[model samples]
Target: MSAAAAATARDALRAATDAIHARLHGLPALQALAEGRIGRAGYVALLRRLLGFHAAVEAALADAPSLGPSLIPWGIDIAQRRRAGLIEADLATLGAALGASAGPVPLAPLPALGTVPRALGCLYVTEGSTLGGRQLARALDGLLPPGEAGRRFLLGHGARHGAMWRACCAALEHCGAEPARRAEMLAAAEATFLAFEAWFAGAP
Candidate 1:
């Protein structure tokens, strides 16, 4: 896309999900993370659950034709990102430190998000999570008796988070600018947030 077109698309994507991102930020699961309501084992539980959920999300993306092709230019493939591995590393380090065993966390069923546009919406939500991961890392740091252990995923892309998110917004703007497409994408992103909230509900 040309510079002007990319800018327009980015703006549209940003405007479209402003409310949805706000709602997700207000969720109990995210609130708990921000408040540091969970401890070492709680964090480990979260990691396991998120890892499983991510695996399922990857499967859906692979199965969904639109999502993969849409994000390929921006390299949004979640599998290649190795986010799940980062989560597992955190779990192992955190669990081993606490002398707690990490077990298989039950997977949450992905929302049936429907269609290619909707799946791209789902990708938007997931990719956008890295921004929040920075906050989560800060909250975890405040967990009293803090250590540098367990920060692979939540550490996110560090200095690169902004660039990644911008790329996603650009893609969204390009693909979801139409009224029908925007609606489908927004619905999928909302569903993804709900699915994530439910998945984290079981974390303890």
Candidate 2:
């Protein structure tokens, strides 16, 4: 088999979603966050928006009964990896500091994660987000209060980030080993990325 043919599921996903990932990077809000140009208000807005997305995504994962079982064999636990509450706490902290309400945020419409492969695809995009978040968290050092208070979501798994990501990759590889399953994973990942792009672009 050629090198490409022998590539792992994670490699295939990275290749398939490269363009979408680039587009996500180009988003104004995300660009501003990465460049450390988005002020506190902008950061707060971004966090609120992120909370909505994470909440919706986690809800989907929770609602899918079979998803948990599918992931168990791969040593993945959706519960341990959830960050929606972190976002909420961050928002609350920032909001309280600003003497404003961290009120309800809007949720994005998600495609159905009816199958394990499809759900894993969504997890691929969400989980991979943490790798880039470390840098994004750094960009917030001077912007936010120099601690994990209002940036917990961005900080992610902290020292465990690397290990957590490796585990996620293993799960993706195991689940996507089959060509048919890999295709579903790719499609769902593409859809999830697009959902993020649209959510970030729309009014928060």
Alpha-carbon RMSD of each model:
5.3, 2.8
Candidate no. 2 TM-score: 0.90
**What is the clash count of model 2?**
0
Per-residue lDDT for 35-136 in model 1, tens only? 888776566656666787887777666776665665676445545554766777776676542233645545677876546567667877777778778777
Best by lDDT: 2
For residue 97, give model 2's deviation from the true position in Å.
9.1
* Clash counts for all predictions: 0, 0
* Global lDDT of model 2: 0.83
Give the TM-score of each candidate: 0.73, 0.90
What RMSD does model 2 have?
Answer: 2.8
How does model 1 fare in lDDT?
0.66
Estimate every model's Cα lDDT from 0 to 1: 0.66, 0.83
Ten contiguous residues minimizing lDDT sum, candidate 1: 1-10
